[model samples]
Target: MSAALRPFDVAAIRAEFPILQQQLEGKPLVYLDNAATTQKPMAVIQAITDYYSQCNANVHRGAHQLADEATRRFELSRDKVASFIQAYDRCEVIWTSGTTEAINIVANGIAQRLKPGDEVLVTEMEHHANLVTWQQACLRSGASLKIVPIHDNGALDTEAFAALLSANTRLVALPHVSNALGTVNPIQDLTRLAKAHGALVLIDGAQGIAHGGVNVREIGCDFYAFSGHKVFGPTGVGVLWGKAEVLQDWPVWQTGGEMIAQVTYHSATWGELPNRLEAGTPNIAGVIGLAAAIDWLTQFDVSAIQAHERALLAYATTLATDFEGIQLVGTAADKIGVFSFVLQGSHPADVGFLLDKQGIAIRTGSHCAQPLMQRLGLPGTARASFSVYNTLEEVDALFRALKKTQRMLA
Candidate 1:
């Protein structure tokens, strides 16, 4: 935690988000759908509004005063993003639509280099964004895709993961945290092992970015990708952070204006590291709002926020354990934010529907992880993910609603 910040206050934090004050079906809102997307705070909303009201001009191409201001803010936000993840160089932080597009950018380059007998390693807990991207990359390149097994407790099998890294492995893609199960992987050690084998590692950071401090240098991964909407920012914006050396020569994901340096009727040349990958007019307001979101989030102490989240998860776990007919899924010791479970003799969708009637917002079904659901031998689970703004009272409300849901289903 930063020395300047005081004790964590859930009430003070909750007041910053206007959306949380509303009601559904005459019940106060208890939002637990954070794994899907987070609600924006007033700081982020004001930043977007200020951008459109003051400087509504294209970046880097306009010569007018509004253009200059717009370009300055746009580039400054890029610097803010570079600092947020502790990235070594600003050029390595390429803007993308979200984690999905970021992963595809890397996959596009790797697929061109892969050949038969090469392997790409991934885990059984991947969101479809990371899993299907590599799957298709391997299919297109004739490389074998190897799946690392997870234990019944939802933790990654470290022994199997190390064994799978062989001379044939060219890339290792894994999620920093499992979106479906809320299982946090040991990414630092995993990245070290992958580096030892000379294979590139990409961490899908959609779930991990909002939980705690993430230092790219300390993790030693070549690439990390995350979405802004998952961290109190605007939608349609994300960041893909890569090693400067690795990204300098990465094949461009798209080709258009802003990405080109020189062009002829027959051929053209690409721009530098960041712009080379980011083609056309970018998501201007989204990027500015994302930068504001991170700035607001960092004012609080990271350790304090993490401790509060851990407490929420611990209390929720205790309540779930004693609740009859409720079976908790993803009981990994290291997880913090998500609580996924199923009701005995009831479908997950039915549980979610009943909970919604009480103004408890949660996610149901595969969570973009059908393979993980199949691995656990279930249809799907109802997931309730916590954020820093959520209160202990909200967690209790979720359980109370679940009790009501159970009785109604019976």
Candidate 2:
């Protein structure tokens, strides 16, 4: 089907992922752990295989035929990432290990310029990746780290966010979507607010990248970071899209390999925007596979996929509402299909264990937002995150299994 013409067919979509067509024990596998890492489709697998089997070589430094092919595909992947996020320029796309490394690059660079009294604002909803990096940066620079509050329902407190901003607020780091709560923050509005306060904004786009169309220029953030694996691409590869003007003269994050322009025993000049930040050999196959994943994703109508996911969330929510012995976590008005809850009188880990007996895979525990869990007064939560390929039948199966789990626990 044409990119514009293909309608979302869940059966067809599920068929593309070989892992989904499996049985764990005697029960059919119902994978609901998408928020951790998406299953790779054949397209991504084939792309990686083609790269290794046909043209595997070091990029950008050789005159051989294999090197030329490798470099072409590797750089084209950069263009794909730039176009995917609507970046200002392809050079603005810097490859990193993943979102953690991407944010580290920014945090480390900013640490060089931060002053003692400078303040950094981050939300309570941040994954530790966004939180810890900035926290350590503040520690290194003697800057103060301020946290923006979230409501009991897990929605970001916009009013409190505004109140926290000040002339001394040097940066505002926020998650585009809360990994634990599935709360989708109003990034564009929040970005505008930070810009008015003259603070640079960085969006941790790990969860938001695949859910909706992302336009970095439209959002007006100084930097946006996302992982390839979160969007059904390869792990160990990610993109850091920053405004060219902001990144062009920024302090270099790494100092070796192609990032250097001139070398001496004592002094070396750094290269331009992207290469200046990307040091050493990159995950070439992972990048190519990520591009292929992007190509595969764009083939389906994004709106249809979104609609399907919404229906799944709504149906699951309805079932959760009527289902006894369950208390929902992170009931934000705006959220993705991450159904997090705890059965009454049972630990989240226990619920997850019982669900797994029925072949339902869910993520249990704090989900890397320990502070958010503390704020919400939960030891942890059982999370069933969704994706475009998930089906309503699978959701039904989840609840059915949950009922059995609750009974077993009771």
**Whose lDDT is greatest here?**
1
TM-score of 2: 0.98
What alpha-carbon RMSD in Å does predicted model 2 have with respect to the real structure?
Answer: 1.2
Candidate 2 regions with alpha-carbon error over 4 angstroms: 1-3
lDDT by residue for model 1 (247-316), tens: 9999999999999999999999999989999999999999999999988888888888889888999999
Residue 3 accuracy (lDDT) in model 1: 71
lDDT of 2 by residue, 4-116 (tens): 65787888989999999999868889999988999999999999999999999999998999999999999999998899889989999999999999999999889999989
What's the distance in Å from true for residue 243, model 1? 0.5
Query: How do all models score by TM-score?
Result: 0.99, 0.98
